[model samples]
Target: MGKLGKRTVAAREAFAGKENLTVEEAVSLIKASANAKFDETLEIAMNLGVDPRHADQMVRGVVGLPNGTGKDVRVAVFARGPKADEATAAGADVVGAEDLMEIVQGGKIDFDRCIATPDMMPVVGRLGKVLGPRNLMPNPKVGTVTMDVAEAVKAAKGGEVQFKVEKAGVIHAGIGKISFDDKKLVENVRAFVNAVSKARPSGSKGAYLKKISLSSTMGPGVSINVDNAVAE
Candidate 1:
């Protein structure tokens, strides 16, 4: 088993559907059901029945199992000078500031994520038109901006992931499947919940966290209570 153990029969049974779900009830249920279960990744399926735009508010993001994303990630590192060399050495498909525009212009800047060194920020900024819609813009907040090429490459290669939220506050991300371990799934769920909570906009007043739900991509969302989840 990579990390999380197999998905328990309990989790499957507990998160049947949203026919009858209250925030607190869902949280207690998930917490209790996942005690001994282990799954590399949590497979959560959501039926928010909302627009993708609104659904964006619900889903936090998706993640790979600890056994690894299980497949290779197409990584492109934006760096120049020494950092470029470091990125290549660390296994990144290095792209330089000089060739940045042409690369973006060629319209083949297809990659799961993009990491740029501090020096390349200007260049990446110039190509905002090309990258904005793709959502591949470089950001340090997510650990994309850097001079440490090796660490960047390692993050890109090993733990590469993406994020987003749905309208119903039902963010769906992946953890290892039931075959991994329950702890892994629990840990992944915890990490995901923390991230989403922190992403709350300052303008979001009152009960920001109205509800929380987790499930597989094709599964159902088990709820998490947030009546007290809002920060004072």
Candidate 2:
């Protein structure tokens, strides 16, 4: 491995021996250690007890962070007629039907979130192979597949975050930015934890939330006490 940079070394030293911290403590530590040139995103990772291989064991949901994610979210909408105009007015970065699919198929997906009206699913469905792997497929469960194009567009550009457990039973997402106030970060963390807690599948056995960690884009991660994280 290459020599560790000064910032990374310092961050690791500060995080040494820290574990099972409260949400606030973890957020503070992560924020303090985020010294990258650009504003670093505050990320959260949760390890759950259930494997996602089984349909019933899957944990997937969306949460709107109390404090919007610091990054600008580019939204692409699949709609037509008035709904298309609504999406554009609400700030969608891209909007279309077959034309959008062709663009996506041509490997030109430039947006972060994708929204589709219910009637546009057929067109969106054809891009499943292209969008599903990236977790960009518009799903009704998360309200991305809906008739309310305007609300969906606004939410996407806002702070809405969608999370799905990986095969190894881990869910990861950016909760906010290190520059956010500690209180806002904590609130975002709690809101996310609560959403995941509520999304616990019936098939989950023993402990639903096995572990949780908070980290910045270029900083070392700190473990958070699962109970404290969910305690509101």
lDDT of 1 by residue, 157-224 (tens): 77556665444434454544544444454555555455566666544445555545554433345655
Can you tell me which runs of candidate 2 are displaced by over 4 Å?
none
Worst 10 residues of 1 by lDDT: 223-232
TM-score of every model? 0.63, 0.98
> lDDT per residue, candidate 2, 104-142, as tens digits?
999999999999999999999999999999999999999
Clashes of each: 47, 0
User: Cα deviation in Å at residue 21, candidate 2?
Assistant: 0.6
- Point to the candidate with the largest TM-score: 2
Best model per lDDT? 2
Q: What's the distance in Å from true for residue 193, model 2?
A: 0.6
Give the lDDT of residue 219 in candidate 1. 38
